[model samples]
Target: MAATLDGLITFFASHHAIRADKVLRDAGFATELASGPKELSPNCGTALRFELSRTDDALAVLADRHVQVDEVHPYVPRTDAWDRSGSPVRRAKRLWGRRS
Candidate 1:
């Protein structure tokens, strides 16, 4: 089977991740940028993932767009579902400083 969560990009900065996502999508590549799992990157909270077969193309596009990506990984997030409902503020308060 092809890589489901294929060309995952781990970026040093969230801005690069966000902009890369947009640029890829505009270029007709299905792409997404998300909060990098803490296990994957402690310095950055954002990353991008796209079709694995397009790794080279993706990198080229990002460079052309002037997005400074830190690293790229073969990542597949655990879940595809998203909570459109904003996370509750109470959860943030309760979990503040609890993360390692």
Candidate 2:
């Protein structure tokens, strides 16, 4: 199967990470600049999270923007309610019908 873009992309520097975030956003992609998971890399403290299916497009935009990337990890974190399935927010959502 082809690779899914449902993963996190690390940067060589925080500035590049920030720029990539902006570039993707400007390109009409919903992305978030999240703390770099130490296990993923120690090169920068920022990582950009976006829809995995759009990884190729996101990477293309980053390259066009000259954003230095350390790595593109095929990581798919728990998306449903996260680790705390019983947290207040999760609980409320579950109570209201949203399981995630």
Candidate 3:
């Protein structure tokens, strides 16, 4: 919560996600590990949340650290709304959001 985390960085694998989190943290960037947004990607279960303005620098750091990234998405999760409504509504939304 130190930065305006408007970006979501996804990975093809969980290891990559974990590594990216560590690497970014070590580089002094604010980050959070969360479930990859279903609307953005389905390859990995984990994703890194950070500020969008520092995306280029973050990507550079990841590259230097040898972390492979699946994609970078501009995402501002509705966590406050979820918190206010609680998990029941969030869970219901997730369940009803299914295709079949």
TM-score of each: 0.67, 0.67, 0.74
Clashing pairs in 2: 5-52, 6-52
Highest TM-score against the true fold, candidate: 3
Q: What Cα-based lDDT does every candidate model obtain?
A: 0.74, 0.76, 0.85
Off by over 4 Å in 1: 1-3, 79-100
lDDT of 1: 0.74
Please provide, for model 3 over 45-72, each residue's C-alpha lDDT reduced to its tens digit, 9 standing for 90 to 100: 8999988899999999999989999999
TM-score of 2: 0.67
Clash statistics: count for each candidate: 0, 2, 0
The 10-residue segment of model 3 with minimum total lDDT is 79-88
Better of 1 and 2 by lDDT: 2
Clashing pairs in 3: none
Best first by lDDT, ranked: 3, 2, 1
lDDT of 2 by residue, 1-100 (tens): 4333467899888998888888888998887778886667788888887777787888898888888889887655544554353245666666779554
Q: Which residues of candidate 3, in runs, are more than 4 Å off? A: 78-100
